[model samples]
Target chain A: MAQVVAVTMTVNGVKSTHHPEPRTLLVHYLREKLGLTGTHVGCDTSQCGSCTVHVDGMAIKSCTMFAVQAEGANVTTIEGMGEIGHLHALQTGFWEEHGLQCGFCTPGMIMSSADLLSHNPNPSESEIRHALEGNFCRCTGYHNIVKAVQNAAHSMAQSAMAQAADD
Target chain B: MYTSEFTYHKASSVSDALAQLASNPDAKLLAGGHSLIPTMKLRLASPSALIDVSSLPELRGIRTEGDTIIIGAMTTHRELEFSKVPLLSEVARLIGDPMVRNKGTIGGALAHADPSADYPAAILALNAKIKIQSSSGARVVTADEFFQGMFTTALAPGEMLVEIHVPASVKGAAYEKFAHPASRYAVAGVAVVVHSDGSLRAAVTGAGDHAMRLTKLESEGVSSACKGLVSASDLMGDHFASAEYRAHLVDVMASKALARAK
Candidate 1:
């Protein structure tokens, strides 16, 4: 076994501390050590965005980085997106729009979509497609996935407007 | 897939990173780890250690010194994509995707010097100056002299790329690439820049073993004479694109970028 290193990061909202081999990837660390299985590993290669997670609020492929590299960073995994009772807008969008079929790519799709919405609250159809170029959805064929993002954008905007009205 | 086990050291500063590099002769300077990590995972490169300079404040932002734009080594592709830099923003936007851009740094890309990487095309065309730091001293080199060969650079031992200095006066620049559908690696990327002197500069990437000056286009003035400037013998052929096909692409992309370069 390689030398184990102490890794500390704030995942979702809780600070996590673990000891793993320095070679362990962030995706594996999240799944194996932290037990956050929501972030899938569709392809071990970096090409697949299935392990997408927000590192310091910016989406990145988890498999491309090591666990220790994320030390002192704030990470947001799929499990952190929302609870079962209180789902995120994209989570609801995926469910309502049937954005997934086999569901292998759902976590990554939702994570990447949320990343897009965070930056550009209102993205065009082409913009949505462009943003999702890193993630692969073999089962969904991307139609429902695109619709899900569009739906989320609409709902998120509506809620923002509602909050503004309250303000 | 996991990278081979290696010692990790996070450097506190550029000098500290250089000291680490000096001590660990086989250590690799880790920036975004977008390219190096992937390569390491495949066991193509198994460095003994990784000196993490990703968080060093000395290598972290974009600033302007008179007419030169100084881009730090740790500036991520995402920053470049949204930055007001002319040809560089266009080139950076076409690299990988949003997620990859969010972590991959410009300095890492240039230092890695992947033959098919996008930034070299723009860097060469813009005549950018690369700032390199080492235990010996710090020195600046133009983009042309910096890229030595495939996966090779002008940096000597214990040296690392620290910043890129680009002229702020570049105008009417454009980058056109036929990116690989799956990997997004450039199949043939051409960057065109219209110099203030009314002259034109162009560089080619992906089609060859390294990014190189499209001297014919520069000499021919970004005109129709750029046709057949690419020689098939100088390019690499894969299943996706043949050397001859890539040669054709260089010509077509150069002209397309030229049409937009004004």
Candidate 2:
């Protein structure tokens, strides 16, 4: 066994640090160390997207990466997107469009979708399907998930236009 | 299977990385970790040190230099998805879902040399070249010469793959594959490239121990009609898929790809 090393990173707009074994996965660091339980660990394997998070503005499976690998990188978990008082548009859209069930995959699903919409505001059904292909939702057959992305696309586009009008 | 406690070193430059590799021969170079980390977690591989090369600035980005498109080894699949090179970008987008693409890199995939990987087929079809560097010097190896066998490559110990070079002569290309349900790896994948001079080349992966060029199919001759060069159904064999099933997919995909290319 090797000594645990200390690493520091920016998580969802906050600076945090931890001392973990070199093998400590980023997901474990987030869930156990930081106590941000919003990121679930359904499968420690990379096959499941349950532990997905944004590393340096790109969505990636946290289980596939190590805590030291994220040293000095910016990370965003589900909690960073919204809270009880205010919800991000994608969160609201998922709820309104019924994009989840059982909800084991919702955090990852929402995180991946939010990342997609950030680059492509109005993605087509095919694009949405392609974007979410990495994420698996056993409960919802993804029909409503697609609809949620569509709805969020419209919502995001409308908001952009409104902001432009206000400006 | 956590990585056994090991020292982590971030290399600031190519020379520095090479020096580190030379000094600590047991250290594993960490790229995207899409391939290495999983094995580490399973306790299949445990190195005494992990040299983190993921942040090496020199090993990132994609650009065209003269007649060749030079893609840095560390360029992420997400970066490749948006590359101005349309064919490369499309191939990148088709790789294992978004999260995988977000972190996996072309050089890392090639270096890992997984038989089922998507890029090997494309690289073979494009007739690309791989650049490798060690403490001694650098050399370029053609795609066909680089891959050895299943999870095997021509890379020497302490050598690192640095870049991939695709020629500009390739006018258009397409990659079509039947992905395995679970791992998303190709059951049998084919990539076809047409050159500006009307020449055609084909490469297949997941159909054998390593991605191979379909020389037998390419040499058979293409039609002058500029369409319907070969039927996808004719390309199947007994390796990654049944001979009959692969033949059917090959003919369909190849014909469709030919039609679209025209």
Candidate 3:
């Protein structure tokens, strides 16, 4: 008696509907049904943060939520974040600061870091470390990851200031 | 891993959720779904249906009524962490990582009653009360009577927890915990609160099968008397630490929290 439910959500600024099993995790739905594979499933148990995404403007582990639960919510995955040419500041920070090695955890890391920067435009070194407690990166010893987030934070702040000055 | 198939019902109100729960033989109330969904994926639980109570407008606010602060069950940890309630905000900050905090709720955490969970310690120390409702009516239970054992609560089968009530005038309170490196759950945690009358209450979690008040410390009537109050038999331990080590940690964590409260 498998149940299927229809869920409608706004993803990457587009309204969409999905008919998935009630048991289908949001992460699986994003990667399989929508072909949005940028959201990885590092640990199905929700420990690893490779499946992180923004739901209603907050970072959450998509693997832990059912697709049906996200009905009418706004979701943002890595694919929706930025394109290859028009990269998000976090993507560029990782590229410039050597934040990642294998690139497996970059999407989730960037999403979580983006959330931290948005909530706190300026975060200290320890604040960045504390904010990233859920996200695990087995590569680069996390030093470069911290540096990357710091770089992105500064860049985003400066751009906002520049835009204000222009205005 | 994927969870076994189950029907989902999005309830618009508490009465609607209660009706669904009563109709389904093995229905579970879903609030935030952090604890239940993970267990379902592991096949630990197989509910016939899930009654989604996360969207109920009545169960989602923080307000003060007279001398008590009432917190709606669906209120997320992120909301409580930044709320005007000082003791709650302090404890909510240490519940889990940012993402977990974003999705976890106070009522869900209390109902789940994970032995290592952070809320039980603070709730017990603050002498909080839980408000639960059913199709028949609603009733309140004190924190001491609400928690029965690990993953067990006093909530009846058809009942859903709706709010948490705490005294508004806590003179001083603090929480201290030694978080597990991997899961970030507390290995040993203590919450101490000094009431307006100057009597102190202390509760310890993660060192036992369920959160319980440190009666010895309370009997001493002061924070400084908490040292050497915990015995080895008072703690339960696993691969992370031994009973003896946890007993020692209970003392250390309690002392640090007591100092902060003082």
- Return whichever of 1 and 2 wins on lDDT: 1
Residue range A1-167, candidate 2, lDDT tens digits:
55687899999899988888888899989999999999988777787798999998889999999998899999999999998869888888899999888999999998899889889988999999889888888998999999988987898889889999999
Residue B238, candidate 3: Cα error in Å is 1.2
TM-score of chain A considered alone, across all candidate predictions: 0.97, 0.96, 0.97
lDDT, candidates in the order shown = 0.92, 0.83, 0.90
Give per-residue CA lDDT, model 1, range B62-110, as digits (tens): 9999998999999999999999887898898889989999999999999
**Residues A71-145, model 3: lDDT tens digits:** 999999999888989989898999999999998888989989988988898999999988888888888889999
Segments in model 1 whose C-alpha atoms lie over 4 Å from true places? none
| Predicted complexes: DockQ each | 0.88, 0.78, 0.89
RMSD of 1: 1.0
Ranking by DockQ: 3, 1, 2
lDDT of 1: 0.92
Which digits, one per residue and each the tens of the lDDT, describe model 3 over residues B223-252?
365667677786786999998998889989
Clashing pairs in 1: none
